[model samples]
Target: MLGQDPDAAQELMHSWAAQLSTRAQAAAELSDRVATIASSAVGANGAVRVTVGASGALTDLRLDDRVQRIPGAELAITIMAAIARAQAGLTEQVSIAVHDTVGTDSETGRAITDTFARRFPKPADEQPDRSERDARDGW
Candidate 1:
């Protein structure tokens, strides 16, 4: 119907353009929020803690004096486990961001969620606790 009326066609096009612009703006805002998201997790009964950015890059790591009791190799494992735990939770944090912004139904949201899921699949929950392991070994 709008084909024969140039003014109507123009108006229709303008409406579509406005909708597209709104979507683009929302996506941009979502990207900014997601980029700023930082996830943290603790492991080995809080002896090791780590924070990771949206890119799963380690941003901060904190080890209390309790770590001095850990063997060098065990400490390395603990640190890595903490990082993995942080990375694993990154997706959920980003999922909330996406849901609040563009929403999970959008293609952009799905892609963002999928990428994080693949990059930081959950770690095994059976990671040995520092105290328990040490006690078992009579350390």
Candidate 2:
């Protein structure tokens, strides 16, 4: 279906991705705001780290150290999901690491891991074949 109407598909996908990114950015902002929850809980003692970057067709998310204690995983998952949901082209890859300032619980890791794993699946049309279009359309 797309080979016969490549331009149309590309345009549709582009528009869809743009909308998704915009929404993801909005959601990122919200999640980032809440990301301080865990760090704040530890007051002056704890810190949270979050990094989000583009990795091919997926978004690479890393949350580590003291940040994992609060809402680090939740925030990371939120941002990842937002990006994956908003951008149809994105597949999510979220990684988390935590250090114990107080103590560690097995459930914490499981919870965050589960959250990342259980996020909603991406839609099929989100991953458009852009290679041919890039060569032909000069996009």
Candidate 3:
């Protein structure tokens, strides 16, 4: 018992709950985006691999099942999206498969782009400010 006021404890719990809900919603959306991106990658049996370090860096990334020679733009977009998701505290793995072979790598590129668009969507006009939170909430 920290001997804090009971009302203060209730406020702390409420703030904690609100913060957790916000994070959970963001993470869920990011997960859905990951799945969409992974399923849309253009390659033969493609997979989007992501690795994150404890410090939250884009530790490692791979696409199309380790195959290289894909367009640099495509790879960059995919890697960037994975990094974004990781930086947002989402999980570190996403996979997508492009079933069409007409363009192969190019199609995969398109798929990756589409996934990025869907995942990143337009940013909200307004965002919550962490500085406004109560100190007892502790994020």
Which candidate comes out best when scored by lDDT?
A: 1
- Give per-residue CA lDDT, model 1, range 12-122, as digits (tens): 999999989988998998889988989998867787889999899999999888989888998898889878889989988888888988889999899999998999988
State the lDDT at 128 in candidate 1.
Answer: 81
- In candidate 2, what are the lDDT values of residues 1-139, reduced to their tens digit? 7778989899999999997786566446434432432210111122322233322233233434544444555545444443455332211222223112111244433454346445534444432222333456885
Report the lDDT tens digits of candidate 3 across residue range 1-139: 5356898888889999997786566556544554433221122123455655433455566655344643566555555554555543322232222212212255444554455455544333322222223233684
Looking at candidate 3, what is the lDDT of residue 70? 39
Per-model lDDT: 0.87, 0.39, 0.45
How big is the RMSD of model 1? 2.3
TM values, all candidates:
0.88, 0.24, 0.29
Candidates sorted on lDDT, descending: 1, 3, 2
For candidate 3, what's the RMSD?
Answer: 21.7
Model 1 segments more than 4 A misplaced: 132-139
- Residue-pair clash count for candidate 3: 5
